[model samples]
Target: MAWAILFLAGLCEVAWAVGLKFSEGFTKLLPSVFTVGFMLLSFWLLGLALRNLPLGTAYGVWVGIGAIGTAIAGIYLFDEPATLLKSVSLLLIVAGIAGLKLSSH
Candidate 1:
């Protein structure tokens, strides 16, 4: 359950990250508001998950999820480069997140 909440938080992190691009330095009103909202929700969910999960594992996984999701969003939405090295790096992050989960509990 904690892991599930942590995953949701990570997804919110991704939403806020992409939201930043849409917000345009917070100049856009609606996007900026959504961004701030997601940021708060992400933090709140993370706090809840922390009650049961180890800090190191939960934080690492959360960051890994955000990084991967944002990178994918950038590639798809923003026409960001999707080089081989970047793909491999994302895979490495996934591996690290998995390792942390396996090492925990």
Candidate 2:
């Protein structure tokens, strides 16, 4: 349940990040509004997850998901650099998150 909320929080993070890009320095009203909404939801979901999950582990996983998912989405959707080194680093982040989850159990 906590993990599920964390995952949703991560997904919201991704949405808000991409929304930021479309916000056009906050000039674009719709995207900026959506971005703010998503950001709020992200934080709310994170708080819910923290109710059950340890702070360090949950925060780490939440950040890991946001970082990696956003990077991948940026590269694939926005044609940001998809360099080999960056891919490997993302893989390492995922591994670390998996390690934390396994060890928590």
For each candidate, the alpha-carbon lDDT, in order, equals: 0.98, 0.93
Query: After superposing candidate 1, which stretches have Cα over 4 Å from the reference?
Result: none
Candidate 2's residue-wise lDDT over 1-105, tens digit each?
Answer: 899999999999999999999998889999999999999999999999999989889989999999998998899889999999999999999999999888777
What is the TM-score of candidate 1? 0.99
* lDDT, candidate 1, 1-105, per-residue tens: 999999999999999999999999999999999999999999999999999999999999999999999999999999999999999999999999999999996
Which portions of model 2 miss their true places by more than 4 Å? none
Per-residue lDDT of 9 in model 1: 100
Per-model TM-score, in order, reads 0.99, 0.96
